[model samples]
Target chain A: MSESEYAIEVENLNIYYGNNHVIKSINLKIPQKTVFAIMGPSGCGKSTMLRSFNRLLDLNKNVRVNGSVHLFGRDIYTGDMDSVEVRREVGMVFQYPNPFPHLSIYNNIALGLKMNKLVKSDKELDERIEWALKKAGLWEEVKHRLNDYPSGLSGGQRQRLVIARVIAMKPKVIMMDEPTANIDPVGSKKIEDLIFELKKDYTIVLVTHNPAQAARVSDYVAFIYLGELVEAGETGKIFTAPESKLTEKYLTGKLV
Target chain B: MYQFDMRRIKEYSFLGVISLLSFFMIFPLFHIIFTVFVDGIGTLVSTGPVFITGTLDDGGIGPAILGTLILSFFASLIGIPIAFAVGVYAYEYPYSVIGKATTALLEITQEFPTILVGLFVTQILVLPMGTYSAIAGAFALAIILMPYVAVYTKEAMSQIPFSFREAAFSLGVTKVKTVFLIIAPIAKRGILTGLLISVAKVAGETAPLLFTAGGLYQTYPDSLTQPVGAIPLLIYTLVQSPSPADHAMAWGASLVLLLIFLAAFIPLRLSIKEVRM
Candidate 1:
């Protein structure tokens, strides 16, 4: 595929923590405005790959990355591209709901807007917050209590609030690192639906352990194993006719 | 069943012994507080409120009270900002050699004698300035408190889950904003409690002020350069005087100091409760 056709392009990527090799020789092309799901068992380097997209791994002291991650043709790892700007363009949601506990729900969304200077006026800020919350499908449940702390929300609501926080930034791509893993089944279902809804507007890189979830919500599926990308293809093809024996074994529940 | 009964007896006896030891350990603390309160209250009742507002020569602790407040305020003003900066730096680079060095330095400073701090300040500020000023005294107290505040700030910043910082950074906020706006606010209670405790600790210290402040000023200090009287210094000096009136004044000053501590500590503990909830 042409580079312009992809929202994110990775070429010969490697990541390390001190002497430990975490991700090895990864290359991926994630198309714009599509849901790309990365599935693997625990310790498979799926989340590491997602974090490297925005350079979130830069926060770790001993981390080392080789090669490049190109976001819309710009090499993000190059010295000229600021990590902060890269993060603004490529946002993330963690496995656990981690809203700012000290801030009210409205402030939690407004903080990014104010910090990024995304809005010119208070009315514009409020409008943007409302739009983001609505996009995350949390506006109706929390509309009356915008000033309440995030700790008051249910686990599902907190996750949605975190999603709203990310959406408020209006990034080109959104990374979910097992977004629903810590939530209840109902919350997980809502998140899946939200992910499906979000694919029309944003490119999504989802990391999940559940093969069924990856099959259900993703347009493209990539399976990773022991710090390597085993296979990646269209979701239907990968699920129905996997190219690798390990992928087939994992899908058939024989080698989970 | 017999083994179970024996286990129960052993546990209860152990609990009883722990309780007795705990009471023994705490006995002196309560006795000192009780004695101070009884003696100080008697002195206050006999001397009246004027004892609090009067000058040292007149058997009043007013100047001393005002002086302690001023000294603690200035010390906190000097110490807190430096402590926070060091704390944030240490927290942000916890694994760096500099961070480890700072941790080691803070531990040593915490254990270093406060009298040495006073002597050090006396050499730096007192001798050169030609007068034992409030500034020197406050500097002494600040050095004594800095390590405590820094340790507290670092621990408070550390207590915040790394995920919160990740969330802020992922939003594209600068590191400064993440630390000051997000992390500091979340760690507010712990930081404030540390500040209060440090203030209380410095307020009660007499040796440092004696060396730097040159205690026993007759009036409230008008400037940082003026010699100032502090409560602990007043109590220390009055208890050694030959006059019975001086002894009574010492009791009153001690009471006032105790009240000051209660005022800081009670609210601090309450705030801790609020934060936990």
Candidate 2:
């Protein structure tokens, strides 16, 4: 693949928590402006791989990363690359809705813009907040009460609020670690729709345990089991006619 | 069925005994408050509000009330920031050696006798300045209250989920910004309650002020370097005097002190209606 075609390229990536190797040496490439899904069982190191894209793993004291993860053709783990800047460029949404309770819905989105000094005027800030909220499909529901605290919102609204917060930063890539795991089915469908819509302008990396979700939202799918990649291909092909026996078993629900 | 009936009877008797014992333990506390209110209110009624501004000889505790307020205000000023800093550091670096040491030191300080703190303050500040100044008393009170503030702050800050910190970090927020804007506001109620309780605890402390504040000021204190009077000190000294008028003043002072404690405690309790964690 050409250099410009990939949003993220991992080379011989390995992660260790103290003496335990959690993510074995792996090589993968995620295309630009597409929904790339990493599907795996619990504790399969899929979340760790997603976190590595933004260097969030650096926060863990005992974890060590070996090899390189390049974002848009730049090695993010290099000595001169600031982790803060990398995080700003690559956003992440957690498995649970974690809108800051101390801030209101408007401020939750406004905070990132203000913190990064992205807006020059109040008008611009308001516009951007509205834009992000609309993109996350939360603007209509929250338009009347932007000043209300996040605790007042339902679980799904709070999750969408979190997504709005990330979108407000205008990051190059958005990573979701089971963003729909904590919401109801209706909320999950809304998020899936948002993910599909987001892929038009942003590269999205989704980590999920549900193979059906990956098949529904992702363009490309990768299956990881026991810290190793079993298959990587088109989402439909991986689900319908997987090339590997492990991927076939996992998709068929016989792999426990 | 007979055995079940016997167990039920035994359980009811045990509960009855426990309730009686609980009431017995709490009876003295209520009795003390009742006696204080009766005696103090009687004295205040007879003496009039002039008793507040009147000197000890004239049966007024105005100077002592002023002194107590000053001491607590200054002590909070000195103690709160240090305690907050220590608490934040301890919570953020919980497993670090410095964090462990700070926790251990604060635990030890909480157990240290207040009188010893007074003696230590006297030796350090009183001897050096060649006078028992109000600043010395404030310093001693601050020391005595520091552990409470630190422990409460640590509890509050730690109660904030670790994921919140990660969320802020992922947004490119600096650690200092995360602490001030996100963590601190969430923990505000906890910190404020701790501060008020610390102030109340130090306000009633008499032994520490005896050696450090010198416990006698004919007029309102004008400077931090001058000796100051506090309600606890006034009550301690006046109650021991032989004059019946002095005894009445002591009762009035005790009433004021109790009121101050209530003033601090009621607001603290109301501020935290719903516990976050």
Report lDDT (CA) for all predictions.
0.90, 0.89
Q: Score the docking of each candidate (DockQ).
A: 0.65, 0.58
**lDDT for position B132 in model 2:** 87
Q: Looking at model 1 chain A, which ten-residue stretch has the lowest summed lDDT?
A: A1-10
Lowest summed lDDT window (length 10), candidate 2 chain A: A1-10
Q: What is the TM-score of each candidate against the true structure?
A: 0.96, 0.95
Q: Candidate 2 deviates by what RMSD?
A: 2.3
Clashing residue pairs, backbone N/CA/C < 3 A, model 2: B54-B60
Best by DockQ: 1
lDDT score for residue B93 of model 2: 84
Model 2, global lDDT: 0.89
Question: Any idea what lDDT model 1 has?
Answer: 0.90
- On a 0 to 1 TM-score scale, where does candidate 1 land against the true structure? 0.96
Per-residue alpha-carbon lDDT of candidate 1 for residues A162-191, written as tens digits (9 for 90 to 100): 999999999999999999999999999999
Per prediction, fnat is 0.71, 0.56
